[model samples]
Target: MQLTTFFFVCITNASSTQFWPGFKILLVTVVVLLAVKNYKFLVLVSHALFLMIP
Candidate 1:
């Protein structure tokens, strides 16, 4: 529920290209932090994101 809401919020709020660089930086930071804790989890997330994109 919370995840869906967050996704919707991001989609709605980030209609401008200006928001993307910050979003990418934030996502990379998160992935880096997760990688430090569990590299496999980061890989899984990266794969999922890649598949979601194209």
Candidate 2:
């Protein structure tokens, strides 16, 4: 919920060309924080998601 709100705020505040780089940085920061807090769960979820793809 908070992440979604933050993403929308970032989107609205930035131009198109700036959005991707900012989003990538935001995404990496989030993933690192999540990984630190739940390393095993994060890995398992990612693997499950990978397998679900065709």
Candidate 3:
């Protein structure tokens, strides 16, 4: 529920500030933080994906 609400808020805010530099930075930071938090899991999944590409 909370995640859905957060996405809704981001969508509404993005519609209005789609070109805002700060928004872009904030989005990048969020993505970076998520990547950092899931670094190991991401690496494992990506490794599996690569192995399947044969």
Candidate 4:
């Protein structure tokens, strides 16, 4: 929920040319934080998300 809002804000604030690079950095930071805080939860969440993909 918060991540989605963060991503949306990041997108709306960034210029199109800068969006991808900025988003990549944001994603890496988030992944690292989640990894450090709870690797198990990250794994489960990622697994569930992956299953949702077509």
Highest lDDT: which candidate? Answer: 1
| Number of the top TM-score candidate | 1
lDDT of 3 at 41: 39
Number of clashes found in candidate 1: 0
- Each candidate structure's TM-score, on Cα atoms with residue i matched to residue i, is 0.42, 0.39, 0.38, 0.37
Q: Provide the overall lDDT of each model, using Cα atoms, as 2-decimal numbers.
A: 0.53, 0.51, 0.50, 0.52
Segments in model 4 whose C-alpha atoms lie over 4 Å from true places: 1-19, 41-54
lDDT of 4 at 47: 51
Which of 3 and 4 is ahead in lDDT?
4
Model 1 error, position 44 (Å): 0.9
Pairwise TM-score winner, candidates 1 and 4: 1
Give candidate 1's error at residue 54 in angstroms.
7.2
What is candidate 4's local distance difference test score?
Answer: 0.52
Q: In candidate 3, which residue ranges exceed 4 Å CA deviation?
A: 1-18, 40-54
lDDT of 3 by residue, 1-54 (tens): 454345345534554554577875575456445546666534543443344343
**Each candidate's clash count:** 0, 0, 0, 0
RMSD of each: 5.5, 7.7, 9.4, 6.6
Candidate 3 backbone overlaps, count: 0
CA lDDT for candidate 2? 0.51
> Candidate 3 lDDT (Cα, whole model)?
0.50
